[model samples]
Target: MFDRRSFLGSAAVAGGLLPLPEALSAQALAPVPLPPPDLYGKNEDAYWAALRRQFLIPADVVNLNVGTVGSSPRPVLKAIFDGFEQTEQMTQAGSEDYPIWGYGSWDDYRKPFADFMGAQVDQMAILRNCTEANSYIANGFDMKAGDEVLISDEEHGSGEMPWMLRQRRYGMVVKKFAMPKPPKSPADILNRINDAITPRTKIFFVSHISTATGVVLPIKDIAALARSKGIVSAVDGAHAPGMMKVDLNDLGCDLYTGSMHKWLFATKGTGFLYLRDEAIMDRVWNTIATGGYDDPTRKADRYMQIGSSCIPTLMGLNAAVAFANAIGIDRIEKRNRMLADHIHAEMMKRGAESWTSPDPALRCAIATVNVPPVQRMELQDWLWKNHKVRIRGGNPSRLRLATPYFLSKSDIDRFLGLFDAFRKMKGVA
Candidate 1:
């Protein structure tokens, strides 16, 4: 178990911040052990409950906002702390070897994540966050004046704004296709992309899973379509890495970027950019220039030459990948789908309009609904301040509920019950 005093004392020394509450401190300091392998076969519910102990969230609190960010679990935190302790000692075997990342290939850290994402180490570049990776795609990619980059209407600001910035500064064109509010099938989305493409379209850039409605786009089909037209395919997959099974080789996109911190439960500053091959790498210029940025022989490592960065964060990322592998991503994906399906169904029963897809293949982990007359901000505030339940949504209506594996069915039930009470309190049916 981590020492509570040490943790609290560090927080105090950092910024004179108030110490965590006793219950929260105890929860943070508690031992986190994985349940026995056989126990899952015997009692699945009990197995999940046991696994929940690994998280720092208090048992009484329900977190339905993992779409925004995830709390790092005990194992990841331990690895990060241990890394800091070992590296800060300033005792290296080699006289010139330093602890900082971003200079060398750092294959030990990059390979594990590359294997997890089904890519070779040469194709992966460990970046700071999804936004930086997106900027790399937008600003670094070779484009001429009036060369169009097509995207969807549902992209997050981080994904879309970079392109917008490029359009303002340079002379490139940015086009958008409106995604179906709730796509019933893959064809519904494919048709939109097909229609949106023009002769001048140089790049097909879109989100693998939309941040707005949590709808999973058909990336494989989109990539193929772009390939047939000789347009480069790039994806902003910020929410796809840990939320579902991602095989970049299978997806066959020219470029892909994602954040491990969102659903992967890794340290906050962990993200990556994947270039499909050397051909694509050659087309992209370096946004952050350093000594090795222009080195063709370095492959994907060339993109990682962005000054000095914390090595401990990469350690946390390795631990996160290990944790997910231990639990089995297939198992985690199933639980995510099951919980999301349950909540989506319950919301449908309550007459909420679905923003997420009805096709199970097009949705996972996140279930978005439009509950009109509910005042999303008001309900969000009421739930967190009064009920210890956390949620996120937009104005007037629209709830984007993210269901991670740690939550139980009863946790969903509690939220549903509270939803009824709140509706009644507001005199809405």
Candidate 2:
């Protein structure tokens, strides 16, 4: 058995990542410092408005599609650029640029990220995106041909598509449960999932928040129920980390995956996966073989070693975590929730409708509105061309509004005014 001491001992001497450049050799893999927070302001509104200035998003464009992809802030971009520049300037001194190998100390990066998500340093694996993380769990997880995996109907493609592939490859039975658009209550959600479980059910796979309608599932309740039945819980949390407070310890899932770019506002191609059970390392196989592939002691690191990928993006991800921490996760969540409420109320006043739930408990920053079927495509084009309001469209045939912490009330009002005017022009009641 790998004891705690031995696991940490291996971590201390573990091949953490690639070697550092000569200029950064003195500091080695030290965590990047966050910019000053003097301008964070005193009051809530002022504080949020001040935060808006840190991004490079153009004033002319109002991006309500943060759910689709988030734009990195100024500090994160700088970290990426600085790290990439340093990497490009490396020269071969003797045998190699700098000698450390086998995935060397991303501990500096990993520690901050772990703390942000309420996870242990050993349990986290920094990957490219949620898709890769989901794939790692789906492919690595040991399942027999007749085993069943329960999933929700509202999950994103990244979360459910992998399970489909797994079913085809391993003959694993995949079962789908109905997820209410605006869940009536936690009990209501649990009942549906509970009803779907069978003797062959081995895993409960669901999204923490639905990408289609922004319904925040009762993950802890769901996880607890899965635990009672001896089923593994795997959550796709692509939209959770930055938009809301995420405490992995409290969430109680066997596996979790998220994207840094979607809401954490990290540079593109940065994501992470968390595993609650260490024994899973032995059962789960790495999709890509690397230096630590065979070392069972490496645990999560085995999944993280994907050859020499974008280290700069990881650096930016570290910076992004620091940025969110400095802002305070609770404050960010409160702001986003408030923004979502504002949009929902305004849309209702304008005779607008939503496919997403308006209940505060069921929703967060995302709000998807139903557009008239005839004008759905036209509304998307008009919003982009005339108003420069970027949002997602489809599924229930609606506009998806994701309120980033940086966005102001004025920006939302501007979009609402344009949308209201368009409705009037189209002769919609």
Q: Which pairs, if any, clash in model 2? A: 15-104, 16-103, 16-104, 17-103, 17-104
Which lDDT tens digits does candidate 1 get at residues 21-83? 666655554567899989878998999999898998889999999999998998988788778
RMSD of each: 1.9, 9.5
Give lDDT tens digits, candidate 2, residues 86-178: 565554365554422236436777778989999988888888889999988788789999999899998888888888999998899889998
For model 1 the local lDDT of residue 42 reads: 99
- For every model shown, what is its TM-score relative to the native structure? 0.97, 0.87
Number of the top TM-score candidate = 1
Q: Pick the candidate with the highest lDDT.
A: 1
Alpha carbon deviation, residue 79, candidate 1 (Å):
0.4
